[model samples]
Target: MIPSSRNWQIKVAIAVLTLPVVFSPVSEAQVSQTLKAKESEAKQFMGLMNKAQQVYYAEKAGFTSSVSNLLVNVGFQNKPDTANYSYSIGMVNKAAVFNYGVSKQANLKSFVGGVFLVGNDTQTILCLNAAPGKIKPPNPTNTKGVLKCAAGTEKIAQYNYF
Candidate 1:
């Protein structure tokens, strides 16, 4: 009876140890499936993000282009002496240009435009007499205006006006 009891205990131990080994392949398969699912979800999320980013930059570029075109039609020129007009448009255009630059570097869709800045002590509406698509090219085009840069000459930075 003692020998038989010892044999039974050994059998129980063997069974206990083998149980996990028997189920390990199934557990591994489940883990692999979970990893694959997560990878697929991440890919989908990245796709959506890319799409959103493209749309956002496209809209921003369009808006900036429209504003610049409007300003050109209304004769909004940059002042060489002062820094007001370029500063304002440059600030706004910088954000848009940065986004566009990132999108372009990421191999995403983007648009381009020209930014012009003009300042007057009192707001004045100047008109462009040129026909559509015949507008003058964007340059310093100060139109004899005063530009006020807070940091003076140290803040002359290159901007993506187009």
Candidate 2:
């Protein structure tokens, strides 16, 4: 009832071919690429929240600290948090600061989005942390009307979305 030598050889070859797929760990490059994708997603999420805040402010005449308010008032669809990041918003010295911090992955970068007034026009800014850790957006300066990120972060984009 035993299989022939040729059949056994073919089965062994097939098993060997599938072994790497089954037991191989993800490579460093692959991990890096995945972390990069998550980082991009975090950034995009911040952008979307910034836009939503713009719309909400236009209708409400003020900014909201709650993402639920953005969803209900502005009709923007998003989860407050994701598997890789957690989102938050609050009034930081008269500015609406949106923050996204790493939730599960250490390699993913954190982000902050700020909505504030600049010379009678509303401005939005997106900033990225220098490295992955718990970072918060700094309060905007009253005299300069600028939203500066904390020392370890850098501003990546700014917009005036009306």
Candidate 3:
């Protein structure tokens, strides 16, 4: 009876140790599938942007205005002080550019900024916004600059390619 009990304990330990190795492949496959789904979702948004003129315009304006404000707040103070600064915001070729002319000239850390989404639903208007052109936000995976969004939110779609 004592010998049988010892043998049972040993068998249980071996099974526990082997279980992870046996199931690891299955988990890996699931992860791959999840990633593919996310990629497909992103592609769908990109396609929408490419075809829908109004949405593209809105996204471009939103990105431009957001970036302009960020630049001004981050020590780029040379503007109208009281009056609002206006810039011609538009998408040039494939990239969104906010042409401010020479109204407020300060040495910017970088001229170009990257746009990214910041919401659970990629289809949501609240999703697309640019990160600050100067400061890289902590935990960029979850937030863009000072903005925070839900986890599993998609980053910027591939509209930049167009």
lDDT of 1 by residue, 63-119 (tens): 233323333443555331121111112224422211111111121111112222333
Give the better candidate number (1 or 3) by lDDT: 3
| Candidate 1 lDDT for residue 23 | 97
List pairs with backbone clashes in candidate 2: none
Return model 2's CA RMSD, one decimal.
4.9
- lDDT: which candidate is best? 2
lDDT of 2 by residue, 1-162 (tens): 999999999999999999887766666568778878888888887888888888877877777888777766766665668787888777765545554444356666678777886665678878787887645545333347665665667888888878
Which 10 successive residues of model 3 have the least lDDT summed? 103-112
Each model's lDDT comes to 0.31, 0.72, 0.34
Q: Model 2 Cα displacement at 144 (Å)? A: 2.2
Ranking by lDDT: 2, 3, 1
Error of 1 at 76 (Å): 38
Of the pair 1 and 2, which is ahead by lDDT? 2
